[model samples]
Target: MQAEIEKLIVKFLNRTISNEEEALLEKWLANPVNEHVFHDYVQVHYAISMDCIDDLRLEQSKDRLILPEIEKVRSLDHNVKPKGFSIKPYLKYAAVLLVVGGGILLLLSKANEMENPVEVVSESEVIIAPGTDRAILTLEDGSQINLENDSIYEADGVKASRAMITYNATKGKISSEVQYNYLTIPRGGQFYVELADGTKVWLNSESQLKYPKNFILGETRKVELVYGEAYFDVSPSTEHQGSRFKVVNEDREIEVLGTKFNVKAYKDDINALTTLEEGLVRLDVDDEEFVIKPGQQVDVNKLTHEASVKYVDVASEVAWKDGVFSFKGKPLKEIMKTLSRWYDVNVVFEDKSLETVRFNGVIRKDKKLEDVLGIMKSRKINTYRIENKTIILN
Candidate 1:
């Protein structure tokens, strides 16, 4: 399967793939990570002959491709807007380079499948793949259901369909009863849910949300993210005759009228955050409360109960919902924390000082562990070891 897929990718690069092969290739690249893998093969192969692999700098001048890696970059928090970096131009430059070969493009064949341009070096050798759509749903009766199972099951009146579960909000007015359902996304897993109030949530890996089976009329539609992260597209308040929407995550509470937001409230983390992408939201943390506008994120310190509001790139907070991992100058520790949850691996720092090393890159969340690490290695922040489920940084 890997050979055929690689062959199809090669044919895609050479522009010689048949119609059927083109369909298959598109199906594979449909996953954003495969697109990274496609570029991975190209860049690694290109670096073989070029001495400027480590210090690669990409310059797009007159549709010409200039392959280079920038060695130095400052640390950016996960929510930091990449002020001066643009990846779209870089990718376009590479795409153009592969087609208009500069006389050294060796598009790999089926035989090259056995030999990867980048190597994976790990101790005890655990090949951890990326996260997928897998989660467990707990109903009000405490009955558990694995969403991954391929069966049509209805729990608490909500129907589960493969990767998505829907609650028909428009069917009629919600009853006064409040029966909560828990959607638990384990490590290396994710799931999507459509609430009875018409709000849609994309739960990231290792997250859990407790929401009422129905949003009662004339009352607030409320949900609680027990832990981890979730992106919510809330239904309009006018649809329910002025009913508001509220989210409770530990010490913080988010009240929204009709808005879209992203929340990350991990159990082990010291802070809870809510990033508003659209509309408006009011945040309540301890004794303080504030109205957050669009493009703004609120971070509430758990210990001090201090809530800080700042504008951010909404894309950074919601990138996982779009099938990509977008980082801008994020420190090693922060990045590893995000990766650990999605990849279900422990990130250990042998020398704690290395945790401050910052990286700026956009990667696909669906890529295999090694390829994802290889991308990091390409950035020169490449000291690490994989022993079973733990990734140790030296």
Candidate 2:
């Protein structure tokens, strides 16, 4: 069977065999041992054709092809053969030529396959735009907190500064009583928070945040975000204890241990994305699990059980945490959604023509909505008439 398989491989390599025979040869070589033999044959042939055997000798002055071993078999004629171990009929001159030529071609084919170039498509326009009025945090104690509101207040005895609440757990351990708090961000705003255990969170628009008043020092620090988008910069716990931060959206749970990452899980959106920035994270959906590494993004379909990982720019995923609106060539509809949130206004498009427009630029959140709209109108996509806190797009 081995000899027959080798002959078939030779025929295929020499282009003398039909596709059926090539398929048969491939099937036989699929076995691990057979594959190794095929690879060795190709490498030996390559060494001979490239004159690498001589180079090897010059470099090491020891390694050689030992062609005499093969030549002895070739020298034997049909009648002249050793008893019990003979190459009487198979060692013809034509057979020798076939073997050598097939081996060379096989090696060349392998080299060509390895050298094949990859095709890369040019950059395309952004399909989705960033959102505004992101999410809010509500406490289990029935206290609702608007992340975009500039009001100052206190939570769990900690004061709120610039719409962010700070808790100090340095003096002692965080009590794990789970004084649940919910976070919700409306359509035109975004907010962030620093948990007691040094975990930082950035919530997108129209989202909610549910967390404890304080993290129990020795227990796992968990936070539940009902719906929306958030980026996490989790600090590693002391003595390498490693903090565990979990984001729960519906039936999906994204688990991370001392990793910097972003989770965009909106209630209306069909997919949930968990993008890793500097550490590892696990995404659990419908009892299945997926592990993601740093610099990778895992996109999970909420409807379908399908999931995939892709490379992403970490800075782009968490840019909202820096108080800047960054768009990477997103469409007009997406841009309008984001604009609506920050300006606390509703956007209505008169004609569908504006939806096709795409823009790529960064705007400060501190900038007035009119200024941003003016820039968009300069591109022929105008916004006219502000009535009842809504902008009409023409």
Candidate 3:
């Protein structure tokens, strides 16, 4: 009976199920036990289809799907018992059909009913791809080098790989003068950098970081986040002769006590946020001092300088550095702003009330813009249409 049902499911997925076969499948589905068998077959099929994907094909394929824990169990052996499956994290909207490329995935609406799946096609000719590793490196001499290509650039004590650049630590007595280098991550791009002091920094899209090529010994190691977001993992004070690290901007500065943290201080944003993941940080906003601990975030109003500290999920705060977009009770407006920065596109809300609609989920950054929009539609957040680089929501 399971084998017969599996054949029926294949026919259904291929959209070639005859009326009699469809009736038999629906009858078998009424048993409830048969549903699990159906899901297992579908999952195995999905996993097999997406196995061994190369980087180039994965990037070019618009249907780069992630089944969360399902990707781990991709075997064709029938004797292997499929573990329990729950689609809460990735697919809470289980009833929604996932239409990607030339494939249509129909999910059961209820235990007893199956809705006819329809392919949701985009009206646009071109799909907006996700961001990549790219940035502009501004040398101390004011010369800029684009880091978008696959070539390696090494010169003047600095070495740049495909997506990251590193500055070698000076061996002898350091110069009193500090030659500053700037790394600017434009829209739809991100980059990593290792400072001479061994501190690591991850610059997000539409962000910039300015740091010295070499740190003067016995002095306070300082770097400036001219504008935008950055995650810092500072080298310990003990590692650098007890020297403290400071990340500064025009209106705010973070004194790092040899720890890890993330800062969001976009130019157009009204509030500057600093979320600590590990260790401690002292923030100065408009001259008012505030000390932040791990698992806490300090939000300072850029205009009024009013500061508020609260406990938050540090993983969601710094998820971008890990190549995932994790949102927890985040408003649609704020989420759109984040997406705008990474995808390098503008979003228009026809209904302003939709901005306040909150959502909680995790999405990989590698997914295409349309896939995200489809998820938003599944959540009943809003109806959307993409026009060139702009996304219109109603």
Best by lDDT: 3
Candidate with better lDDT, 1 vs 2: 1
Q: Mind giving the per-residue lDDT tens digits that candidate 1 earns over 282-321?
A: 9888878889887788988888888889987565567677
Full ranking by TM-score:
3, 1, 2
Mark the 10 consecutive residues where model 2 has the least summed lDDT. 101-110
The reply for model 2, stretches above 4 Å from the true place, is 1-140, 144-151, 154-157, 170-176, 238-240, 378-385
Models 1 onward score TM values of 0.71, 0.59, 0.71
Tell me each candidate's RMSD, in Å, in order: 12.5, 22.2, 12.9
- Residue pair clashes in candidate 3: none
Each model's C-alpha lDDT?
0.68, 0.57, 0.70
lDDT, candidate 2, equals 0.57
**lDDT measured at residue 283 in model 1 versus the true structure, 0 to 100:** 89
Per-candidate clashes, comma-separated: 7, 30, 0
Say which prediction, candidate 1 or candidate 2, comes out ahead on TM-score.
Answer: 1
